[model samples]
Target chain A: MYANRQWVLAQRPAGEPDLDCFELRETDTDAPTDGELLVETRYLSVDPYMRGRMSEQESYAEPWAVGEPLEGGIVGEVVETESDAYDIGDLVTGQGTWGEYSLLAAADVAPVDPSVAPPEAYLGILGMPGRTAYFGLLEVGDPAPGDTVVVSGAAGAVGSVVGQIAKLNGCHVVGFAGTDEKTRWLTEDLGFDAAINYKTTDDYQAALADAAPDGVDVYYDNVGGPITDAVFTQLNLDATVAVCGQIAHYNAESVPTGPRKLPQLIAPRATVQGLLVGDFATRFEVATEQLSEWVAAGKLTHRESIVEGLSNAPEAFLGLFAGDNIGKQVVQVAAE
Target chain B: MYANRQWVLAQRPAGEPDLDCFELRETDTDAPTDGELLVETRYLSVDPYMRGRMSEQESYAEPWAVGEPLEGGIVGEVVETESDAYDIGDLVTGQGTWGEYSLLAAADVAPVDPSVAPPEAYLGILGMPGRTAYFGLLEVGDPAPGDTVVVSGAAGAVGSVVGQIAKLNGCHVVGFAGTDEKTRWLTEDLGFDAAINYKTTDDYQAALADAAPDGVDVYYDNVGGPITDAVFTQLNLDATVAVCGQIAHYNAESVPTGPRKLPQLIAPRATVQGLLVGDFATRFEVATEQLSEWVAAGKLTHRESIVEGLSNAPEAFLGLFAGDNIGKQVVQVAAE
Candidate 1:
C-alpha cells in the first residue's frame, strides 16, 4: 500500500515563523468510500491567506489546529471514483488536505480544464486568486476609465491579475512589488502603466508621485503597513481602497500600530472596504470564464513559481512574505 | 448707526486652541441695500468640525482665513427687509458671520419655524446635526433591524442624533461618552440600550463585552482613537463603520499614530467610509421635514447645551473638545 505524506501545523508562531512550526509526516492512504473519489494531489497552493490559518487568532478563515494537516486549494487527478460524477484520470481542483492523497466527496470538487492552460493554472489564475481579483477590483475598487489604479504586492497571484483587469477596464494601472524582477514583470509582461520596486525605493511617496502623476483613484491594497500609509497620502478625491489582504502584518506577534488614515479619508471622502472572495461565491463561474478568455486572448498573463516535492510545501508558503516568489507559489506534490 | 461686534480668526493654533487664536472686533453696520435683508443674529452654532477650519490642513470644509470674521450656521431675526420675500421680525437660519448683525440676501437663508420646536432647535435637531444623523445612519451606517449599533462620542450633537436614528431603525444602540451624566442622558433619555463612560472605564473590551453581548453590527464612529480601536475588535461579520467625525484627534499638533486596524477589518469584512452632510444636500429638505415630524411626534429627543452671548462664541467653540457640553453645543448670542 502507498503512503500519503502531508505537512501539519506543529505549533503556533510567535512572531516571524520558521520551519519548526510545520511537521511533515506520512500516513496510510485510505480507500475510497461509496461516494468518495480517490485524489492524488498534483499541485498544492501556498498563499498569504494560509499564514492567518497558521495562528490561533480570529480571522476570516478558521485557524489550522496543531498536529492537524493544513487544508488549501489543491489540483489533483482522480485515481478512482465510487460516484458517477467524477471518473478515473479526470483532473479536479478544490479545497483539499495538503497531502499527497485525499478522499474527497464528488460534489466538493470542480473539474479542471488543463486543455485551456496548464493544470496548475486551475489553482492560480483560474481559481480563488482569479476570482478575488475580478470582484475585488471591479466591485470594491470600482476603477473608472482614465482613473489611476494602484495595486500593492503587485506580481503576486491576485495583485498581478488585478493590474491586468484594471488595464482592461481602461484605467492606468500602477503596481508596487518587492523586487526589480517582479516590477519588470508587472510593467513589461502584465501591461501595468508603471511599477515600483518597493524594497529598493527610499521614498515610496516620491516613487508613487513619479509613477502616478494623476494620483491614485483606486488602490487595491494587499500588503498593509507603511506602504499603505504612503499610498493614502496620494489618494485622489473619492478614492476607493479595496483591502484584499494584509500579508505584511500577518506574522506580527501583536497588532502593529501606524498613522491613522480615517481623518485623511474624510478630506477626500474616500472609502476603505475589506473583502473576501467567498462573498462572491455565486459569481465564480462568471469570473473564471472571463479570466480564461483573457488568458487565451493574450490579454492576461500568469506566471507561477513552483516548488518541487511535498515536504517543501511549508518553505513555499513561508517564501510568500519574504518576496521569494514573483507570482503564484505552488508545490508539486506528485506526478499524476 | 449701531455697531456690530464679530469674532475673527487671529492665528492658527498649534495644538489646543486659546482665546488668543480668536480676536473680537467692533465694526459699524450699514443700512440694508435694495433687495437685502438686515438680520440680527440670535444663536451661533459651535461644532467640533470648526477645529479643522482653524488649522491650515486640508479638510472637507475650507480653512478660515486669519484676521477675517469666522462664518458658521447662525439663527437670526429679520430686523429690516428690502425684499418682498421676507418681512420684519421673520426668523431665519443660514451660514452667517459670527457677529450681532449681518446683511443677507433673502434666498440665502431658510425661514425658521418657531412652532415646531424652539427657534434654536433649527440649529440643532432640525438642522445640520439631525440631517447628518439621518443620512449617515440610514445610508452609510445602513443598520438593519435587530442589529447592535455602537456609537462613539454619544453625547455630542451628531452622535446623539445618530444613536436615536439607529434606534428608530430598530437596532439596539450602545453609546460611549466621557461623563456619567452624558452616558445617563444617552441611556435614560435617548433610548440607548447601554451607555459606557469611557473615561472611567479602564478596560474597554470588557465593557463592550458586557454591553454588546451579540457584538457590534454598525458602529457610528464620531470619536476615532483608542475607543474606535476597541470598537473595531468587537465588530460582527460584515459590519459597517460610519466615520462621521474624529473629534478626539482634531487638536493634535501632528497626525497621531495608533494601532493599525486594517488587519482587524479583514476578518469582519467591515467598511469604513467618511461622510459629510453636504454630500446629501439634494435630500436635505426631505430629512429636515422628517426630523421636524419626529420632533413633533416625540419620536426623537434633542438636548442643547446653550452658552449665552456672542462674546463667548470662542469659549463655546473651545468647549466642544473638552466635552463641556452634551448633544448640540450652541451659543445664544442674542434673544429674539
Candidate 2:
C-alpha cells in the first residue's frame, strides 16, 4: 500500500483557470493486480490542451468532471508489476493520474530507456509533443525544400521541435515566441532562420513579411489569435496550414471572434487542416525512432521547465497560458 | 466594322454596387487581325464571382479598374476569323468583352456544339460553374459514400450542382437556400435529402442539426457568414470543406469579422480548402465530358434566369447580390 497525493478538479472554470479550480487530496493506493503496474510518479506533463478538459466544452479530449481526479501524461518508475511486459525498477511513460502513485494497465504504458536520454524526455521531445511536431508538420504541413515554414508558439514544446524539423528539411524556418530571450534561443540555439517576439512586435504581418519575403509556404499553428490572422494574410499559393493547437482561445467563455479568413484563403488556394497526434498512433514507432536518432546526433535540441513537487502541478499548468515556460512544462513529483 | 454596345466600369464600388457603377458606351469593332476572330456575342454570363472584380480588394480574380470595359464569359458565333482553328458561323465560348461584338484571339476560344445542349447552356452547367462544382466537390471536398454533405448557398449556380453530384455519389445531402421556393426546388426537384431556408430559419444551427442528425461529413461553402458559422459547429470527424466561393461577403467594404473557427476544427480535425476552377484548367475537358454525359442522361439538371439585352447586363449582375435570380444568371445580347 502507498499513501498517495492526488489533484482533483474542484470546479469548472468559466474563463482562465486558477489554482482555486484544483484541490489536492490524500488517497491510498493498493498493490498492482493482473496486467497492472504500480508506478511512482517522477514527472507529470502539463500541456495547453488540458485547458479544454477543465471546462465542460466538447473537445478532442473528454472533459474532466468536478471533484474527479485529474489525469495527464506521466513518466514514472515501476515499483511492482503483475505483467511480464515490465519488471520492477523499470521506467515507463503513459497516460496516468496526477498523483504520487498510479496503478496503470501494462498495455497503456510503454517502457522508456534512460541511457539515450533522461526519463522526462519521454514527456517532452521524445514523447507526445515530439511525435506531434513530426507528423503534424511533415504529413500535414508538407514543407518542401526552400519553403518558408512558420510556427506559432514556437518556443514551446511542440513549436520548438517543429521549427528544427523544418530547418532539417531545408526550409527557411521562422517562429513566433512571446519573449525576446525565447526568440533569440530559437534563431541561435535551434537554428531557426528567424524568430519574432510576438509580445513586443506591433505588426505581425510586417514582421512576417520581412522574415519571409517569399511568403509562408507552410504554417504550423500552435497559437491561434491575431498571430494566426496575420499568418493567413501572407500564405503563398497552395500553402498548407497545420492546425495543431489553438491555445489562444482555449479559455474563452464564449466563442471568440476574429477576422474572417475564408476570403483570404481563396486568393492563395491554401489548405487549413486541423490535427490531433492520436490519429497517427499506428505510425508512432516511426516518429519515435527518427526523433531518437535526431536527439542522439545532436541535430535536435530541447529544454525543460520543471516545477518541483506534486502540489505545484496546477501552478505549472496555469503558467502555460501566461507563456512562462520556454519549452516543455513538467512537474517533478519525486526524485528519479 | 460592327457597331458595339459595351458596359464599362464607371467607378469602383464602396459597398454593395449600385447601377451607377456601370456605364453603357458605344464603340466600333474592326476586322480580325492576324489570329483574332471577330465574334458576335450571344450569351453573357453574370456570376457571383464578378462581385470580387468590382472591388479593389485582392482576390483570386483581378479587380476591374474604373473606366475599363467589363468582361465575362461569352458564347458567340464567329463572324470572321484569321486562324485555321475556327471559321465563320462557328459557335464558340471563352472569356469575351461585354459588348455586342468582340475580337478574340483564336487560341482563347473553344468551339461548342449547339446540339449537345443550348448555346446558353455553355454559359451555365456545361461551362465554368459546372466544372467548378465537379472538381471542387470531388477533389477538394472528397465526399465518401453515406457522407452527410452540407452546402451553403445551395441554390446557386455551383452549389445546386454540388448537391446533385453528392447525391449521385451515394451521399445524404443537405442544403441552405435563401427562400422556401429555393428550398423546395432543392428537396423536391433536385433530390436533396433536406434543405433549410436560411432566410426564414431563425436558428441555422438547430435547423442543420435536425436536417443532418449525424453531423456534416462534407461541406461545399458558397456562402460565408452566419450560415457558414453554423455549419462549422456540425462538422464530423475528418470532414472536408471545399471553399468554392463566399458570395455573402464579396461586397463588404472592409474585412468582415466572424466567430473564430480554428478552435471548432480541432475536435473533428476538419479540413477547409479554398479552390479556384483555373487551378484545374488542365482537366477541364474531363469535367466537361462528364457533366455533358450527366446532363444528357437526365442525371443532372440546370436552370438559367436570363435577362434580355446587353443593356440589362449590369442589372443582371446586381440582382445576384439580392438573391433575385435562381441558378445561373445570364444576359442575352442578341438572338441565336
lDDT of 2 by residue, B146-250 (tens): 999999888888988999999999999999999998999999899999999988999999999999999999999998999999999999999998998998898
Per-residue lDDT tens digits of candidate 2, residues A183-294? Answer: 9999999999999999999999999999999999999999999999999999999999999999999888889999999988888999999999999999998999999999
How does the DockQ of candidate 2 come out? Answer: 0.84
DockQ of each: 0.79, 0.84
What lDDT, from 0 to 1, does candidate 2 have?
0.93
* Global fold similarity of model 2 (TM-score): 0.98
Which clashing pairs does model 2 show? none
Model 1 has an lDDT value of: 0.90
Chain A TM-score, prediction 1:
0.98
lDDT of 1 by residue, B1-336 (tens): 558998999999999999999999998878788887888999989988899899886668889999988989989999998889889999998888899988888878888998988888888889998888889899989999999999999998888998998888899999999999999999999999999999999999999989999999999888999899999989899899989999889988887999998887777888988888899999999999999999999999988999998889999999998899998989998975
Lowest lDDT block of 10, candidate 2 chain B: B56-65
